[model samples]
Target: MEIVKNRFLKGVTVVLSALLVISLMGCGQKTDAKTTEAKTVSENVKRMPDEMTKVNLGLPSNKNMSYLPFYVALKKGNFQKHNLNVNLSVVQGGVLALRGLQSGDFQIISSLPESVITGASEGANVKLIGTLDIQSMYSIYVAKDIHDPKELKGKVAASMVPGNGTDIQLQYWLKKHGLEPNKDIRIINAGDNAERLQTLQQGQSAVTILSPPTDLKADELGYKRFLMRDELKTYNHNMIAASGDQIKNKPEVIYAFMAAEAEAVTFIKDKANRDEVIKIVMEQMEMKNADAEKSLDFVLPALADHGKINIEGIKWAIDMVKEAGVLKKEINLDKLLDERFYAK
Candidate 1:
């Protein structure tokens, strides 16, 4: 009777041990499955979007020649190839584009360095990423009756808009002639390219600043080109700037744009593809062949070498602004230039 009871107890103990082993195995299997699932979930997670990183391109309207490199890059899909989405915004004038950049409406503003320096002095968060034009592609045009820049003391002159690159250049030209701006010359803020054209035609302004396409228009209308860069011992233009915040976060996008831009500048400068490039320039700008030619001529010397930043040109522009009382404090020129990206 004792042996039978002991045997029954042993059988019960064996059954309970088997059940406990099976339950432990089940728990281990569940733990392994959860670990696998957690890893899978981690791998499947999506990256957070950089809401602050976006490219806003601002250029001038009507003067399509100024946008040659950008258009070439866009039409050739260079920007897209580099994994960037650039929204091209055409403003009325370069100054307006600078203002848009300052007001936070645009990310990249295309204009002369003077505007950027002025904005920086005024405490706007801006920095010049790169320069497209290193020399003066602009000329000061006056009526045929007026030859000397000093002849327009009492006469009315028009610029693209107040504080625009055109205005700043015109002021610089005026100062070079030993004339005081705003006091010696009655400078008016004509709206933009079209308005400046209208102002010149309607005799609202005796003298006006003009670029290639507009200068071609001015020539067709018989406006006299009294002064060009060849006449002045100066380098006149530069691609102004973008926000500093944009530079820190969206450096990769800027690198892509700069690389493509460098290629476009090289292509435009090549004599082999000159005609084709001119045609593309005309088609993109919607200008006549004569205007296209004029713009190409203007862009020829102003365009810098491939992927090169004009440190001297930028310094000159900054110095000019400082002299003009546009900048309140001096800035470190080296800090403004970041070439480490290209090096990488």
Candidate 2:
């Protein structure tokens, strides 16, 4: 009777062990299924293309080194990396660029802070997002025979469209030297940098304001170049601006664009990447190595801190426009500038 009882307990133990083994196998199979599922999901995510936002960026001119960060961002694929399909359109002047932005022809614009301020004061719905150069990138280049600002009196000064940043700066500079713009020096719309340079060469104008490689070209031609920032200082020269609708409706796109611009500015400021940057400048602006190097040297220090806007600079620009009689009334800073996108 004892042997039979022992046999029954052994049989029960065998049955329980088999049941446990089956349950463990089932768990293993479930675990393997979950791991496979996770891997498949990850692979699909990797294969899917990122949704790119298309943006049109308008600029007064691309020939100047002031726009180098944008060029770098485009050439280095920084915009693409941030999922932006950016298209750059070069207009003749800041006013035209702003007009394009207002007309919905451009999603963003790089223009003078003064232009944005003036536009805002005039009921235009635009806001400054970021700045490229905190200091003025312009320099007054005179004919080879001219020595002083007074020498430019009764002579034509070549400029972009009236109310453009260059034209406004020229007027301010002339006024500082006791030379009224229209009376002492006649300012004319002589097209872009290259065309303005041609005007000087062809004897159509005696003085003009220019930036970068164009200034270098002017220097080579024996033109006397006077730096605008030497005295004017802290003017918001080139700024990134967008419409109010863009700021209100597409905040994420604006942030992405600023992120790409910040990255580009960082890449440009690095000394280790000097040669590559110079190469990019040469390719974009069609400049020689020496000219590119000189232009880069002049512009590198003037770039804003990671494309961030300068409040003091913007204020200075506003005052300048008011003094120049370009801006008639006071502008509200809160309405003119939207810092949320680039606050980081």
Candidate 3:
């Protein structure tokens, strides 16, 4: 009787051990399945497409190479890749572009820092979000007869609308050369690139600021080009701005637009994309191969690093605006700039 009891107890203990092993194996399988499921869900979320968003972007001029990054973004589908359908509006001048931005006609505008500073100072709820080009794309072009900067004194200088990028650069250049902007050399809102070139050709203005292909055209017309010094090159010539409402409300849209722009800048800087970039310039600006190549070469170095806004450059622009008498009081950098959307 004792031996039978011992055998039965041993059998019971063996069965219990087997059952426990099976249960542990089942738990391990379940945990493995859950981990796999969780990983797949995370991957699906990452691959999910962003809802398409339409964005109206205002530019001073589409024909100029300064806005090349935007054109590249559009042509290369960078904006669409980021789920942004960006529409371009040629608003003629930065001041008018900002006005369009204020009136709700445009959600964003690319213009000179001066326009932003002046507009923000005058109660326009706008912020400089990013810059397309950090350096000035402009060169002072003079009529065939005028050879010296001093000779430009008392002469009319063709520029875009007052407070435009070209206007600000022209004033800064003139001031640096000991020539006062309005007092010594008269600066007029002559018009866009072609119009300014016509003004110079018609002798309406003795000197005017010209960027790429237009400067090349000026050269062909026997006009002399005066390259600005490195100091003036630091000016934030082409900056992207948005209203306070847009920055506050639709931040995702801003991020998408900036991501596209930054990609475009990267694309432009890559030498492997040289032919493609030139093709874009030709198609957008309506230029020939050689002219487009030359324009691209001229404007390539001016592109901002991943569309990053230059705070020091902004400070310099503010001081320059104050000196230009466009802004009466100082502008707070924090209020005037919102760089959160710019990807490094």
Candidate 4:
């Protein structure tokens, strides 16, 4: 009787162990099923157009107005409309932005036409796709005491840097006014708008080239506007550019980006949207409303209308850079202007 009782207890123990294992297995299966369901649900929803193309776009921090269209497109959902995943990076200046383009850090860069031309001449395989502004909103502000560019001769004239757009303008301005670059005038590399402003304030430099916001500030501080030659009869203050390889391989992506910007341009040009435009520009630039408003008014006329590429503006830029002796080779105009993606 004792042996029989012991065997019965062992059997009962085995049965309980088996039941416990089965219960644990059931719970595990349910958990896996729920996880699978969640994954399927996540996969079913559309995922930002599957990142059809990736782009790194570069802009300068100084030209808050020049980047207004980009900000509008981002805030207003134009980029998503065209199905593009573009990453826009704010840089110190247009020259640095162009450098990012050269190193393949960014696929598209907004810079002065002169920088692009100078880069192409230096063997960087890049081309201009479209423009943001095609006229002169820039001015040379000399110390109120200095009267003329000829007076600027032999005095220290400061700009961001050589090969930079503003510097190119300075060079062109001096040349037009019959001042030789190195001989007739002394051009120094002043760091940026802030540096230029400081140099002018301290009287370290007699003249400096400045764009909007800073330019207006310079004017308020009593810096005199020296010349307005409008070197570019057809000027592009800001442009979109990419490598030749990108144009060939990812033309569709490039076109999509241009299309989004075109929509932004339209919204910005409409005076009815002035408040909205100022809000976007100010927020993106982290600037005051008053400053942003002044810059917008200054650059509005120069801004490209919707998606239109002003061929004349491009020609003017090319001509100015050529005269500055920045370009070593002839720019193929047809190869440069690619506006097929913009809506008619």
lDDT of each: 0.71, 0.85, 0.83, 0.76
What's the lDDT of the predicted structure labeled candidate 1? 0.71
For candidate 1, what is the TM-score? 0.75
Error (Å) of candidate 1 at residue 160 is: 4.2
- Candidate with better lDDT, 1 vs 3: 3
TM-scores, each model vs. reference: 0.75, 0.81, 0.82, 0.77
Model 1: per-residue lDDT, tens digit, 189-255? 8876667878888889887777666677787877777555764444536573667776666555566
- TM-score ranking from best candidate downward: 3, 2, 4, 1
TM-score: the better of candidates 2 and 3 = 3
Candidate 2: the clashing residue pairs are: none
Better of 3 and 4 by TM-score: 3
Off by over 4 Å in 2: 1-50
**Candidate number that wins on lDDT, 1 or 2:** 2
lDDT of 4 by residue, 30-143 (tens): 999999999998556332344656678888675456777887888998887878767888888766787888788998888777777777767778888777877766788888
The list of candidate 1 runs beyond 4 A from truth reads 1-54, 60-62, 94-96, 99-105, 231-236, 341-344
Runs in model 4 lying further than 4 Å from the true structure: 1-52, 92-96, 226-232
